[model samples]
Target: MAGGYVVGVLTETDNLNDLARGIAAGWGMKEADIPRLAQSLGQPQLQAQLAQGLQDFSDDNATDFFVIKATGTGAQTRYRAYTAIQIWPDSAFPVTRNVAGSAAAPNTLRIFSDFQCPYCKQLWDTALPEWERQPNVYRTAHYQFPLDFHKNAFSAAEASECAGAQGKFWPYADVLFDQFSSWTRLDPKDVSGRFSTYAKTAGLDTAAFKTCLGQRTFKASVEAQYKAGVALGVRGTPTVFLNGIKLMDYRSAEEQAVVQAITSATPSAASIIDARVKSLR
Candidate 1:
C-alpha cells in the first residue's frame, strides 16, 4: 500500500462472507467485521502484496463485496482501481444548449461529448435520438468535451455552437456525426472548411456560419464547457448524467449500472443510481 491507500483482491465467488473476510484479511485481521471496515481500514502497507480475498462481481447485479486489501505488488491478477468522485447536485449542470425537448421536462440528460470519439458518434447515432424522441422521458443538454488528443474536436464544438447561433444546433450535430468518418479522415487544418460545407448541408446561412466559424466566436464557450466537464470528474468523452446523478464509468466491469441509471424510471432513481455507481467502483 502507498499514497494513503491499500489494495485488496477479493475472490470471484458468490459467498458474501468471503467478500467481507477478504477485506478484513487485507488489514492483517483474522476475522471479517463489516462495521470495522467503514470505520477505519485505510492503512498504508510497508510493501504492496497480492493477497487473496473474495469478491462477488461475477453476476450482473452485485450487492455485496469482500473487504480485503491487497499488499505487495507484482502479481498477475485482476486489480480494482478507485477514482475519487464528488457528488454534484442536479442544478450544477444547467442546460445551456438544450439539444432536445424542454428544459422543464421530467428527466434531464446532461452529456459531455466530443465529436471525434467513435463511441460518442455511436451514442449520437443510436440511443441519443431515441431518447430525444421520447420528449417526456428526456431533455438533453449537450456540453462540449473535446479530448485533447482529438485535434479537430475543439473546433468542431465551436462550429456546433455557431450552428446553435443559427437555431440549428441539433440538426447540425446530426450532420457532424453522420459525416464523422469523412471529416476525421482529413487533416486537422482542413476540418473547419469541411464543417462549413456541412453547415450548408444543414441549411444554415453559409455566409453567416462561415463568418462565425472563421472568427472563432464560440471558442471560449466551448473551452469553458470542457473545463467544467473536467472539473466535474469527466475523464473521457460522453460522460453523462441522468437528472444530475453522475453515471458510472463506461469501461467498468459492471456495464448495466450505467445503463440502468440512465434508463430507469423508478421514483427512487437517484438513490438507485448512486448505489449502483458505488457498487461499480
Candidate 2:
C-alpha cells in the first residue's frame, strides 16, 4: 500500500516495487474501505476477510493498521500478504501491560507470544537474552497470545502474570520457555503443578504465586492482551515489534534482525513509520 491506498496486490508478490505501477490503473474503490476491497480480490475457492480491526498508532487521533486475512479451504489454509503504509509511536507501547525492562528505555521490543509455542520459546531462549544484555538499549514488553489450540497456554500465561506480581516476570517467563518440553506435554490441570515448580526456580513466593494462579487473578488481563495482539494484526504467536515495525512475519524472527537494528545508525522504526504517515497526509 502506497500513500494509504491499495495500488496493487498479489497472492504472493514476487516484486514488491511493482506494486507502485497500480495507481495508473486504480482498483476502482476507496482504499480506506479495506474490507470491501479485500473481499473483491478473493481468489478461486479462497476469500480474504479483515480478521482484525484498525488500531491506533498511539493515544493520538490518527490510526494505522494492516488488513490481513487467512483464506481457508477445508483442511488447507493460506495467508495473504498485505501492507498498509503506517506509523508507529514508541510512546504508546503499552508500558502498563507487562514489561521486562524500564518503560522509558530508549528502544522497544514488544512481543506477542504463546507459552506453548516452540518458535516463541526459541526466541525467548536465544534472542531475548541478547536484547536484555544490551544494558540500557531496550525495553521489552510481553503480550499474552495463547492460541486456542494450545489448551494449556492461557493457564501458563496466567502463571507468568502471577509471577510478575512478585517482580519476577522475566525469570518465570524464562523457565516457561526454557523448560517448555517438560510441562507442555501435560494436561491443563497438571500444568498448574509445573508452574509452581518453575515459580520456585524464578525465586517467587511459591505460595503466593500458587494462590494467585489458583484464583485466576490475572485471567482478564491475559485475555485482553491476546485481544490487543489481534487488533494489532498479529496472526500467530511470537510476533514481535522492534521499535514498532513488525520484525518480519510470524515465526521469522531472528537474532540477526535485532543485531542489525540496534547496531545501525539508520533512523529508528518509529521515525521511518512517521515518514510513511506523513506521506499519507
Candidate 3:
C-alpha cells in the first residue's frame, strides 16, 4: 500500500496583501520595508509551520491531510489550505436524479439548484456545458433546493422531478431554464399548464406528465431533496458539491478549479486503512 497521502495546499494572497499594506501604512514604513520585513520574518518557514500545524490537527482528528500552498509574491504572499474531511457518508445522499454523463462514471458532481434562479440558470448555461464535456471523467447529479423568495421555483422543481420520472429530466430542465422568464412572472396557477407545454417540447408524454403533475407524484421527493440540501448546509441555489466537497464557486475559473479538486482529491486515510485490512484477509 502507498504511504501517507499528500493533500494539495492552495493559498490566496489578495487579502494578505491588503493586510500587509494596511500594517505598513500604520507603521509609516516605506514600500520596500514590506518585502524586507516579510523575508526577515521567514515567510516560507512560517508557511511550513502552519502547514505542519494543520497536518497535525487533521491527523489528530482522523481527517485527510490536504495540501497547503502560498499564493502571491513578496510581502503579499498568503497561505491557503484545504482539508478533504469526510463529513457525510456515501449512504447519506442516496437520491441521484437528472444525471448527465455516463452512469458508470466514478466521479459525481452534485448540484443543488433552483430551476427559476437566474444564477442557477447561468451555471447551467455557462459552466455545465464545459463540465458535461468531460463525459469520460464524471457525471452530474441534480438536486432541487428552491429558495423561498422565488414564488414559482418550487413548482418548477416539482415539474422537473415529474419529468424525470418519465426519463426527460435533463431536456425538461433545459427548457425550464431557457424559458425561465416566460413562466416565472406568470400566474402561479398557470405554471402547471406551462410545464405541460415544456414537457411536450422536451419529448415527454404530455398526458402522462399532466397526470403526474396533477397527482403531484414527485412532490415528496422534491421536498425531501430540499430538506437534504438544507441538512447539508445548502443555504442558496446553485450550491455545488464535487464528490461531497462543497465548491466555493461554480463560475468560469472556479469551474476548472472544481474539476481539478475532484480529479486530484487524495483518498482518505480511513479508506487506505480499510483497503489494507481487506487485502490482509
Best by lDDT: 3
Name the lDDT value of residue 22 in candidate 3.
41
lDDT of 3 by residue, 107-165 (tens): 67789999889999999998888878988777888998988888899899989988899
- Ranking of all candidate structures by their TM-score, best first: 3, 2, 1
- Alpha-carbon error at 248 in model 1, in Å? 2.6
Greater-TM-score candidate between 1 and 3: 3
Clash count (model 1, backbone only): 17
Which has the higher lDDT value, candidate number 1 or candidate number 3? 3
lDDT (0 to 1) per candidate: 0.65, 0.64, 0.69
Give the per-residue lDDT digits (tens) of candidate 2, residues 1-281. Answer: 33223322333322222222232123233445555444444433433232221223321222233333444443454443433333345554444446766656666778989999998988887878887887477777888999999988999999999988888888888889888889989988788988999999999999999899999999998887887777666788788876655665423445435433543435543444345434332
* Candidate 3 local distance difference test against the native: 0.69
1 or 2, which is superior by TM-score?
A: 2
User: All predictions: root-mean-square deviation over Cα?
Assistant: 10.9, 10.9, 10.9
Total clashing pairs for each candidate:
17, 0, 7
Per-candidate TM-score against the hidden true structure = 0.62, 0.64, 0.64
